[model samples]
Target: MPDFLLSQLLVSVTLIIECGAMQLKNKNYILAALSVSCFFNGFHYLLLEQPTAGYIFLFSSIRFLISIKWKFQWISAASLCVSLIITVSTYIGILSIIGFFATIFITIGSFSKNDRFLRLMMITGGSVWLLHNLLLWTPVGILVEVIFVGSSCIGYYRYYVAHKPSEP
Candidate 1:
């Protein structure tokens, strides 16, 4: 298989797992799927020679695993510090900054208990990633972001709009 196709296959798997995660009611299951998604996403980025983004996903996968037991504060603090270092060291351009913030947003959002907040963050991060993919000239990455955003929107509608409490 071509290198790009293989990379896209990894990203495709991540997208499928994310779709399943959005449909699940259980937070643990969602986190587990997210961890796997991160692993595949990171591997895909690595294949594309985007080491910073790849490493961020790898780090996020580890974060998700630790967050299965650890508190949010610890995770956020560690993630912010690591993100800063990676961003500075990578120093590509606008995309690096976008990647940094997107990673942080996704990291915090993934651990949130509020469904709306999580989806909101996902949308925000997905937007940034969309731009990053465009700049990086990665068609697969762009497609993944579009699909991810669509999934997040559907999940948000189902969880927040369809199930909203009626006001007294």
Candidate 2:
């Protein structure tokens, strides 16, 4: 495990680069994003016999930043999928397809003003990322991840129905 100081430093750096995590005004969101980055970086450096997997987090972060900086949602979406797959491939010996589902949800959610749906997608993606983390080293993490995703799914479905256009 990374020392508390190192993790705090990493979180601080990520918060600064992501503009104090302004896009994610909620502190929880910022913490989640930074923590995910930390997990990937830590995994690559501490575990993993080869250590090439850490770059996946960097690529994903860059892609995420580009979307916010340049407003390229598609690029961000693609990068998210790529990063998810890279991380999952390294850890999981089996396929779960959570990345694919999350990406599709994100891509669809990105083109609209459905903030609720977008949040759901982000939460779902985050949950999957957590699950992937658990699958890699700690099997107990999946239960928590599932609860988080499930709660968000309810909100998402509600928004999807509310925003849905009606027939003529």
Candidate 3:
């Protein structure tokens, strides 16, 4: 199979896993699914020759694992630190910084207790990712970001808006 097809297949699976992650009521389960998604995403980036992005996500999975035990503040701090290390070491250009910030935003969202804040950060991160992928001319990356944004909105509605008690 072509590299694009293989990479896209991985992304397709990641999208499905992300959907499951978003719909769950249990935070642990959501994080577990997110961990899996991140792993697959790392491979997808590798296929795209964005090894720095791949390394960032692969390293991020460790933070997610730590998130299971540590507090949100710790996770966010770890994420930021990792981003700085990756970005500084790689130093591709301005575009590389976008991935770093996006990683931090995603880490914050993943650990946040607030449902709305989680989705908002997800949308924000996804938008930045969309721009990055577009700049890289990565079709699969572009598709994943677009779908992720739409899925996040749906997840937010289902988990928050739809479940809210009707006002008196």
Number of clashes in every candidate structure? Answer: 0, 0, 0
Q: Can you write out model 2's per-residue Cα lDDT over 1-168, one digit (the tens) per residue?
A: 544345345434433433322244343453345445434444342333313234444454454434443436666566656756665666533323543443455444333344555556557565655656464443223333444455455544544555563421
For candidate 3, lDDT tens digit of each residue in 133-168?
888777767877888887777877876788773421
lDDT of 3 at 17: 77
Residue 3 lDDT in model 1? 76
Clashing pairs in 2: none
Q: Which stretches of candidate 2 lie above 4 Å from their native place?
A: 1-53, 77-92, 95-114, 138-168
* Best-to-worst TM-score order: 1, 3, 2
On lDDT, the stronger of 2 and 3 is 3
Q: Judged by TM-score, which candidate is best?
A: 1
The lDDT-based order of candidates, best leading, equals 1, 3, 2
Candidate 1 lDDT tens digits, 31-85: 6778888899998988888878888888888877776666477667887788789
Poorly placed runs, candidate 3 (over 4 Å): 165-168
TM-score of each: 0.88, 0.45, 0.85
Candidate models: Cα lDDT each: 0.79, 0.46, 0.77
